[model samples]
Target chain A: MTDAVSARERILARVRAAVANAPEAAAVARDYRTSHTADDPAAVLGLLHENLADYRAHVHRTAPDGLAALVAERLAERGARSVAVPPGLPDAWLAATDAVRRPDEPRLSPYALDGIDAVVTGCALAIAETGTIVLDGGPGQGRRALTLVPDLHVCVVLAPEQVVASVPLALPRLDPGRPLTWISGPSATSDIELDRVEGVHGPRTLEVILVTGG
Target chain B: MGMPSFPEAAREAVGDTTLRANLRHATHTIRDKRARAVAELDDWAALREAGKRIKDDTLRHLDTYLVRLEAAVTAAGGTVHWAADAAEANRIVTALVRATGETEVVKVKSMATQEIGLNEHLEAEGIAAYETDLAELIVQLGEDRPSHILVPAIHRNRAEIRDIFAEKMGSWGRPAPDGLSDTPAELAEAARLHLREKFLRAKVGISGANFMVAETGTLVVVESEGNGRMCLTLPETLISVVGIEKVVPSWRDLEVFLQTLPRSSTAERMNPYTSMWTGTTDEDGPSAFHLVLLDNGRTDALADEVGRQALRCIRCSACLNVCPVYERAGGHAYGSVYPGPIGAILTPQLRGTSSEIDASLPYASSLCGACYEVCPVAIDIPEVLVHLRERVAEEGGKGHRLEKAAIKAASWVLDRPNTLAAVERLASATRKVHPKRLPGPGARQWSDHRDLPELPAEPFRDWWRKNRP
Candidate 1:
């Protein structure tokens, strides 16, 4: 056997011997509240908006029909010359935008992605209690870099459908096999004198559009 | 030179006015914010209980969960390596980096790596390891030891950091901007520009995990700045060296910690970024992933029943913030990567009490019980400190022998009532002529910092008998 294999065996033996006379651990009691917020959908959506803004993410609410125009307006407001479009994003979402479209057909290199001015993608889910949005690299959500590299990220979250009330409720809905990124706000750091300063490395500007009605 | 005891080390720190002010400002700011954040959760007590229980369960069956975790990570196309101690772990990582023919690697700020001294070891073998997190970057550039767990350079103020960056950044890779100011925002921008070049060109990345799930084989990194994401996502070959006790039994266990850790560490609703990945992803992140399970001295700690709960720490640094002793003495006084209340108990167990520093660590606290109250896992640090003190005393040294002899003499006198009464009467008669301080080696040292209590005018037994009769 190799050295690594022998080491593994020895470590395991030590662990077993260490706990041989130990008493059984008490069963984990999970009586903690699953959702701190009420069960109403409007309340959950409202909480999500308040939290996202609390972390300095600019938030806006709009109807599904107004999303394309809203997306175009956000991009133009940021003065973005180019926007990276993730695979399977609805074609009409960018119909009204005149900015050059950079799709992830052949995945963009890190260097190339850095040059893009903005990225617009959909999310897998959003947690209200924590004000978090999780991206699983599914349909509208591209690879992690699509949202990470660009200076600006315009994330579209379909409300009432994709929003959850708490973290416990957010876990089971996520698939463990896929790569996940849970973003609460734009990149920030509290390293200097323990004072928080936003916009470090990840998308410095996070614009979230909560689409209320399909 | 031998390392000084905790008192010797703490005395110097207490005298430094600048360090005392820095610790006071930083710790006080976070303490208030953490209390408010925790108060928002009505069921915080239940969550803390569940977190403690889940970790207990995981440690109880660590062998089973580890084996299962290895299998799951393997099935997901990642290779698992086991390291029995720090030397072997360093050897494995060095060889892995050498295999890729890369002399440089980007790193996320991880306590496990700090515990093993990975960067120093790698540097000895001709590799350059760059720390990406903003606080870690400050420490690395300044060539200073980490004081706080979450914020390694908490000892530094804004001016000190700006000086370190301006003076050292050029030699590392990118230089700080000309005429750089001391503002936190400008300083952070300097780090972003410096690390971005390394991230874009890096072939290998090294990290440590906050949590590793046994059932799904997923690893989690909870971080504040975007630096963690850059290193974890940009590199081609990602290597994570995590302690053996980091594994949880299942994925659902994260719900408890996700709520508690953010509030406890940085006092935030949720940190800016958290990355979760299982093994390797095709064309998404790293193509090849390596998970190193490090044991160093954890199994030895596990063998000790009272000392084992130190393994449940999430490295939140909350205990360090509220500790009165830590506030005055600072993190460097603890003399290890782990510091404050957690370090006082943990360093002794992991490193053993043979050395002077380790022996003195258990006595570092005043037994105020602040650390116990703030601990998320509720490890009674004072209980473990007293238990370790018993073990230290039993080892039989000069001071302990004197203590034992003194205790024996007191017990003997108390057992004989007549002799005790005679002694009490003599003490009362000589009270005016008695010396202010006890004249002895051990007793003199004890009385140096504390006032000698005055002898009572009369013994309690005599007063009680006369009054009652």
Candidate 2:
């Protein structure tokens, strides 16, 4: 099976090469400038907060020590009985919370995940410019579905990891062969009449926990 | 089924007043909302410029980005398959499904799947591919091809949709409740109940991503309905078929697109559901994940220096909404899975300007610039249309031959002053005996809808000499 797959891959590679070389449209160059300072992480975090708020995502901040407690308290305030945690989530982060902990399991179905009140996971990276959080199915990220099926999701971001950059700079960090999810904010839509509706596909509520001053 | 001639299919759509009304209303509503939503952002122009630049740069450095993306995804424990065309893509997906031993799959709304005719091919293999999007479900139940890009069932009104539900909902599973009304809530409820059953029972899911981040090896899908979320997460084995061009340079790059796509497409500030996934995880979601990066005609599209701009399209359908011809003629007229201005240029380029319908598509538009103004990527659709018209004329032997003959005859007569004067004299002398309409074997039908200009007492040149010269 691997051999056949390789053969098919080889054929497709040749086809792509041919298509790429075909004479068609000329490329148009676009010019745009950005005013982001990459040197300062705080500046990046500030941009992230601004963008997140712009997208209507709720933002909260705390020192590393108070991070988990804040998340737990927020969940409790929302009346969440159980919160879904990714496999690699830090145990210390949830130590302050008395809420029922539901670790994300492979066998858990969509129906099962739907039963969870909320989900919490650490992000692979956060882009401040666009107010986007990226999960690369990493340790605490779990599968894409777990984050998507639940109504509420709490994404934890370490301040230093935030990048105040363009897409070209971020591309080198991602793996093309893995399942990677990029989230801007909570799911939302507008009807034909332009009435905005939130939480149609993934989480209806998104709370970003930016742990700063480590 | 093989694609039929687009003009004939379009002729039928054009005649259907109800379908036209539905499409006009739906498209206009979305278009207006998008304008308003886009207006709320002061940096929208800058964002659009950034999105366009990123896409262009990515396409330019696609080889590097794709390699980087593949390495990242593989490193993260995901499998990636490259498919050259529709047949290859379908074969890969079918094999993946077969390996999972799943005969039925639930699908999110994916234009890539439609472009490749994935459902029909899967059905041929005795695999049932259920469309989970409400609009897509209507199209599948009605056994019809989608007319609109975003709203696949835009041609259908509430009443027609209710009838489709009444007749076809039961056979698929989860019959519509008795005495279903055409109200939006009831219709949504019926579809919700129907899809929930499929989401639970299906073991495999198929989807297409709006963007694939090369940096993180992540795939993203933006949808309004929760169905896409269900399809992405519910199944144990998930397969995503994406056009190779869907790739972006990085996660940060996605921000620019997320802002522009929703407003340009559904005319919203944000999509209701934006789902992203990278690779498989040990204890969450689908155990096995497969990414099928399909080139199909995109590489061909990319190769064209003038035509490659079409690749910049986010498939927002903004161009379709503002197009005057599309408003009256509907989507089916352009043919292929893609329709309107984008389809006119894209389908022909992908398939080649060989077929009669494809050749005709270049001429379908009125060369209006509306499509360009509304295009988020700023594709000069009219410019492309004219460019394609030249290509068609060059390739269309019969049309070229007749045009050449007509031009040669006109040149011979005009080149000589005596010949022109004599002809004018002869025409005027015979004016009284001339037919009230155009003469000749080929011109009878042409003059039916038009009046033959009254013959001047003297020719224009003759009058000019007598009056002015």
Candidate 3:
């Protein structure tokens, strides 16, 4: 086979040759707003909560102190026996839970993650207009598989801080070097007769804990 | 061997009542929801326009952006390879998998891979490629071609899927439960169980991206199911075969597309899962990453002044959902990986109109203009179709020459007032002798489907004179 350099040079040459005399692209007119709503953090959080639930994700609100209890209660309510915790997750957040905690220190294998019932992670940003929670595998967020293979995902969003009004606002705050998984609702499909059915291969139930600092 | 042309294949699909009904029901359901989803955004027009501008700008400077993308990806610990066409891409991907010494690879649903016939190529090289998406799993198990862009098996109803699974599942891996039902939830559950094993065991993963950010070197795959997540993260090696046109300039430019794509495709404010990765991270996802930049016929399509706008398509399939031709004739009729109005204009331009199938594609549309209205990038599909039709006729044959001469004669007689009136009188006088269908040649195909209109008994002028006098 010919080497990579030749292929690279050839393909680029083809592109340059093709567009040599093509019309210059017009300037991008970004007349769209950054935030569809006003710049109020609280209102953005409210919209985020409403939009998340509109897509059928179970949404809840709590303060920093109540987070451990809320996470424990939500896990128990789902009858979950084990929860996967990312390496950097705060131990105190799950201090109140009786379920076995599986910390992903060396990275949980897919088989290992499969046995866990829920995963709890912090997010990079949440877009309110789209009801999306973007996880950049930051502190508290582990590998992408940890959130994916589990039957349920309990994501912790730092309200007012993590919430952005729209996609434009969310992109600037995120670091793209880290892997990002944006969960709008749980994994769902509209494939069968175009009927929207939630939960296929991803987490069946997504419980979002909006951590508001009082 | 030559494949059957578009009209030849379309005739079969259009005549199938079951396929027609299935496509009609599926397309109508998605079309209504897509309109509702698009109407929710107040800045949708601006968003759409920005999306077009961003794509146009990227295409205009594709070589520069592609070079920048390669450097960024390599800097972030991902190896990049460039493929000029399908065979080269398949060879690169196959060798990458071989290097890992693993035979089985899991795949996220990707149009680029399908366009290159990667699965078949992989199979030829002794690699087992498993399609992890639900609809893809159905099509793969049934040994069928994908009909629609988003929902590949839109031509198959729930019952047909159950039958495919119940019959084909045992040979692949886990068997479907005895006497499987056709319920959507139940079928989804079966697929979840059937594919989960492959996801857990797969050594190498393959995917195609929705958007590739050139500045950040980030690749994004927006999907409804978590199957993509499994293939992306669980595997040891990751290879993404992305079209060169999938690239955008920056993260800032990505915002406009993220807003428009989901609403236009599955008709949601956002899809269920959107995965973005720049390169390999420490024990987070894959240890090694290979970015295969594919330029198979994309540059050829990009060279067109009017038709290059087809490259602006994000594969949203909004046009497919509203397309009357696709709803009735179904996806397989287009005779390529891409189907519907976008396919009609794009398939010809990308692959060229040399083949009988590609040539027939331009005439597939009724020039109804519905596809243009709903197009996110505002591709003037009808205008491109007419342009392509001219090219097809330019490759003139005896039939076309006759067609041109006949049109000229008709126009000449119609232009003269006396000659036009004389012909009209002759037509009404001979109304009783006129055949129900054109007797021969020129419009035999047209008259086969439709009856010639009855002579108005008298041409309008004759009736007007008799009534007023």
Q: Can you list each candidate's DockQ?
A: 0.85, 0.21, 0.80
Once superposed on the true structure, which residue ranges of model 1 sit more than 4 Å away at CA? B397-399, B406-469
lDDT of 1 by residue, B1-469 (tens): 1778889999999999999999899999999999999999999999999999999999899999999999999999899999999898899999899988999999999988998999999999999999999999999999899999999899999999999999999999989999999999999899888888888888899999999999999999999888888888988889999999999999999999999999999999899899999989887889889999999889988988998888888888899999999999998888888999999888888788888888888889999999889888888888988888877888874356766777789999999999999999999889899877878786898888888889899988888889985
Candidate 1 chain B, poorest ten consecutive residues by summed lDDT: B396-405
Which one wins on lDDT? 1
Candidate 2 off by > 4 Å: A1-107, A115-143, A150-214, B1-6, B40-53, B56-65, B250-252, B397-469
Q: What lDDT tens digits, residue by residue, belong to model 2 across residues B3-41?
A: 555656677878989978887887777777778878866
Worst 10 residues of 3 chain B by lDDT: B396-405
Cα-based lDDT at residue B55, candidate 2: 73
TM-scores of chain B, in order? 0.92, 0.87, 0.90
Clashing pairs in 1: none
What TM-score describes the B chain of model 2? 0.87
lDDT digits (tens) for residues B300-335 of candidate 3:
988888888999999999999999888888889898
Per-candidate TM equals 0.95, 0.76, 0.93
Model 3 compared with the native: what TM-score? 0.93
Model 1, residue A208: C-alpha shift (Å): 1.2
